[model samples]
Target: MCCLRRKKNKQGQYQELISVVPSVPGHSAPVIPVSQGFCARHGEIPFSLPPRCVPQNTAVLRDAERQEKEKEGAMKVDAQRDILAHRGSLSVGSWYPVGSVLTGLYSMTPLSEVVAPPLGMATRLCFSVEYRHSSEQLVVSLLRLSNLLPRFHSNMTLVELRLLPDDRRPRQAKARGTGPDPEFNDCLIFQVSAVCVLRSTLSVCVLSVEKDGKRHAVGRVLFPLEGELGQAGRVLWRDLDPEEETQCSELGDVQISLSYSSSLQRLSLVVLGARGLQLLTDAGVCVQVSLQIHTQMVKTKRSCVVEGEQDPIFNYRMTFKLRPQHLDDACLRFELQHPNDNRSEPPALLGVLVLGPFMYARGLQLQHWMDMINKAQEPVRMWHRLGRAI
Candidate 1:
């Protein structure tokens, strides 16, 4: 879930940013694409997760899994994709294989591109980006592995979600939420829910929106967990004006941009915002407390230094090498700092993790991932529930 709250500017356009790092985190673990299961259409794609087998002991479960893999018996599963058209006479749609992310690794599909629709096809706007994991066997291998053991069969329900606006309505917000109201407003917030099934041995890397766009800086809002809300993961966003630039001014100047990724529901931020003058302290984000999750693990870097207060948005970044070692399933969580509370200051939530990392089948890769997971101590909790079905 992503939470974004900031004052609107004179031009009705504020700054936004999103960044990507090397080591992957949360359920968005970067995994190799190896399989291709079935072809997908643009409306609603159906898929399923592999079943669970409760082994009495750890050794017993491992042994049974080994034997089942050796037998070569297979489970046939399917997932479909939907093709969507935004404008003009264009052939645009999302592609999917016949299987889940774990099972799909066998067909050798090379992921080489980001996701976007083509240009010229859409009227005044166009975005055709595709992030490819593998070039070959994108879905075929997922078929083979699904047959061998308990795996995940995912049904991807695709939505042609866009940060669209209507001209008939005023695009700007009222003065400090007091003046005349604007007609058309999509402030990038909505009720949402998600379910992930990861009860298997295969792993996949999460391709994030910030990484795909190669964006430099971003605003990260951590959502709160409240049961009555019903929907928690759905999000909406608007593009910032292209004219504004952060020139290291004294009045606070940072270009804020954002990205959305289907794989990782939480918005991953790119750290590179403007550094204000040292005299002015880093302006803390006036946030609404709503962060929720079961903390399986979390690692981040935060240091305070300001070049000037002219820019309130100060950027900091930390890299976390993650791997899920033990799992009932994996979930990501963002927690608020207690000390920041009180002092007329609302606690800021950096992130809320919905999913965690999964590793590959190869021995070397698995070993490396296992090492990373072992470092994170358990007994952590954020808002959990997304991993139950995955």
Candidate 2:
């Protein structure tokens, strides 16, 4: 039989109510029932279930990777096309994209061939001139050079002074500066005779020296000494004339007579004389003439040495045996040489002259050669200008 029971709270009020079943003497506890056939075949089921395995699709991933590679290849091809289009147009300081890398940063323009224009500048010279009666010497002072044009490469410059007709000795002074205007506070002195002082003129030339030891005349100016400035020196400025227009007095001039004999197969060349030869010292100077066929020198002759003379006379003659056929390829080279004081050093070359056919000659030199050929046995005499060694 069942019975109801009531409990009291701490506040003296009825709290919980319960129903209880009365137990009989010697009774057991209650148990839950289960199916015996299912329990024997399988284990008991778990409260939660495990997740299932699923297969993945790889084709979609491969397609996406191929598309990415194609995009990269297209970008590379476009970069190469742009580089080819610009090519040499890219300046050294500018930057541009090369393939996938950024090279320089500037505009991309098509490259084209360009030619550099010839550069030239008007030059001026500042100098002072004076003649000392007591010393019987002419003095030239080079102050400075202005408006000099910069060369494509670095070079050395010097000023050369010569007292014309009477004194042809070259006196040079080196200039020093880092800019277009150079300073040359240097003096040059030349001995002058009383009779020739009034008639003498000062020839000034500016020469540029290269690394190969070759000298080129840049410009020149001529100053006469007839005025009162010869007694009391005066500073003056003069405009330099172009090398082509101005006559180079330092190189001097040579007179020669050429004749050929067809029957004897002989060529006769006479070394008459040379005047206005510019020398660095009072040493003896001689003229050496050589006959060259093609590249080999066949014969050579030299004139007598003359000392202390601006104009030297040499009546020496030379003859070369050659056939008419060889004339087309024959060339004559004349060199002016002076002995050096020091035995250790070689002889110095003053000037040179080359005469031959059109291939080896020009201007007066060519004209002289043609006249010798046209006139045959008749002697053709002409004056030729001397120049630095080729």
Candidate 3:
């Protein structure tokens, strides 16, 4: 039987070959069959044998098949690249058929995980409360007290959410108060500053409007944020208390009066005195008053320092020539400070009084001057309460 044999040529490399046959008389060449083996990296594989005459058609056919497979693979890789490029443009919340197929390739990290903790903390703290009203009547039938509202009715009620310690503006959610079993399903969002999460309180106030168009506080609930940060989907019910009210701790009081003259176009601030000052230092206390017109400091006045007295009496008057229309953008600031003999120490802040939009009206003019003062000489004087500085 004929069998393939291994042999080597002058280069001294192993080569597999069919046994040599006798020379043919008509062909004039030795009849030898050559079999080719492929090398992956190099195009052609070299064998340790002398070149023998063979048909080229078989080699050409094998090359054609290899090129066809390479073209098909290149097309598939390009298609995959385009699909990934398009997938990157889609938002996280969006879904597509292609996205479903490529789910394993995309990151599964949530949006909160990639962002800051404060933003995630705010989102986790926000929740919805269901309010079930017990009364459906337009007006309370049992409210017969003279001090109560004339015709108290609640068409709509809103809940105010105040996240404390940072003192950001409160957030509110409203619902229709129509039926006896009306469910508010109101979503309240509160952004808690990260610095105060450990020591903050969440106060919610429920307010309803009366027939006289005045909104009155009906109930309030306060929640302390001890360790309730990670609880996102938990629902808690807080019964509203009609007698509850959100009140700030009393700091101190200052006496002041405001007057505006139309003819002179001047706004006068009369600082009569400050009583019951809650200063921390034993040093004498002095009051510093600054008037800002459109957030620009226009005038500043300091009171005479009282020696060893908490309640400093300084009849200091500061006036500014301001346009009547500027009342919309003007604010009066009063800061209490201790007069320090040591130049190295900064002035200690006792408390501050800020008369903002609630105290003054934007439409303050000669015609609207009646609302400010009942009579010309009698400037409206009141004991202004001091709170934390803005």
Candidate 4:
């Protein structure tokens, strides 16, 4: 009888194989015949590369596919490059005289990201200067505010912008409404310099913000903001015909006045939100702020004091300084906080609220300042060399 040999399995089950006895000393090897069980586990063996993962042929296919993908990517890049080339290089970082900046650089809104509707909304801007400069310079480009144009798509407008030392004219541009920010649809240059102070102002006439007029958290011309910020708004308290929260533009010269009344006081501004007034203290630090809520009837006779949560309009005035890095560029941030409202709203007005680098309030003219920087105390090197040659 033929000997049916079996192979041992870990599970104690036997796998069959053919056993052959040879006459030669070492020819007793068993050969398995071609049968159903012989090739049962076709794909069970483990291998390094993936199945059909051919290195040479698959690599060639992969490389070709990769090349095709790269070519497609190149087309997209080329299209963008062509678009950029069509639009000449933009001048952005050049420093220029404070006076040369557009009158109203729109302080546009980041309304786009939070709500999608207010994204690219145009914002107003204004800067107040109270000093002068010894030397200053001006830098400008044709496309300063191009990034914020998608929403309004309006060519830059110098809406009610202001600059320093105007003829001291009776023009109500300075104290009245303000200009827009650079991010607004307008590309207006709002810079000024003078004997007393240089202030820059910017404004955007229209913006594409989401929300109906009167109750709109920031209204139509909403400026975007971040973190905690302070905002001041004119409120009609005690006697109300249209009592609900109304925007500054809706109030239309309703007499809103903010001042640092206390002598040597750190009166930081706080936005009176729905829950309560949030004091914008120094960034990243918890500061104990002392506040005094009073009435400034400068713009109106309906004077009402500010308190805490119970009253939104008559809330105590709070003030704190944000670290330089966290200081917002807006004069007035959101006055109220709606849970859904991200603090990305810019101030209603644009331009530097705090007198900055070249303003007279801070120092002096930008051009003279640049002169001081680029000017040489000694003779020019080229002139000195010529003199030595002589």
Best by lDDT: 2
Candidates ranked by lDDT: 2, 3, 4, 1
- Name model 3 segments beyond 4 Å from true: 1-249, 358-377
Q: Which tens-of-lDDT digit does each residue in 193-311 have in candidate 3?
A: 44455476666655565556555555555666666544544444444444322222377667776777766877777777766677676778778888787658988878777765656
lDDT of 2 at 390: 60
Candidate 2 local lDDT, 295-370, one digit each (tens): 8999998887877477888877889897899887998999888877797997788789988776677645765666
Q: Which ranges of candidate 4 are over 4 A from the true structure?
A: 1-139, 142-390
Model 2 global lDDT (CA atoms, 0 to 1): 0.72
Better of 3 and 4 by lDDT: 3
RMSD in Å for model 4 = 27.8
Clashing pairs in 3: none
Evaluate model 3: give its TM-score: 0.34
Each candidate's clash count: 116, 3, 0, 71
Task: Report the error of model 2 at residue 220, Å.
Answer: 24
The root-mean-square deviation over C-alpha atoms between each candidate and the true structure, in angstroms, is 38.8, 26.1, 19.7, 27.8
Instruction: Estimate, for each residue in 1-390, the C-alpha lDDT of model 4 and write its tens digit.
Output: 245777778999996565443233343543333353456354654335446655656668888999999999989877765655564444344322122334257665453232222234333222211221334321111111222333333222322222322311111111111223232222222233432222332111122222332111111111211211122211101111121333222212111213332233322333222222232321211111222112211111111322323223423344433233211121221122112123476312111111112322221122112222232221111000000001
Q: Write the per-residue lDDT of candidate 1 for residues 78-161, one digit (tens) a residue.
A: 122122222222333433333234444567432112112233321111112111233311110100011101111121111112
Worst 10 residues of 2 by lDDT: 110-119
Q: Write down the TM-score of every candidate.
A: 0.20, 0.37, 0.34, 0.18
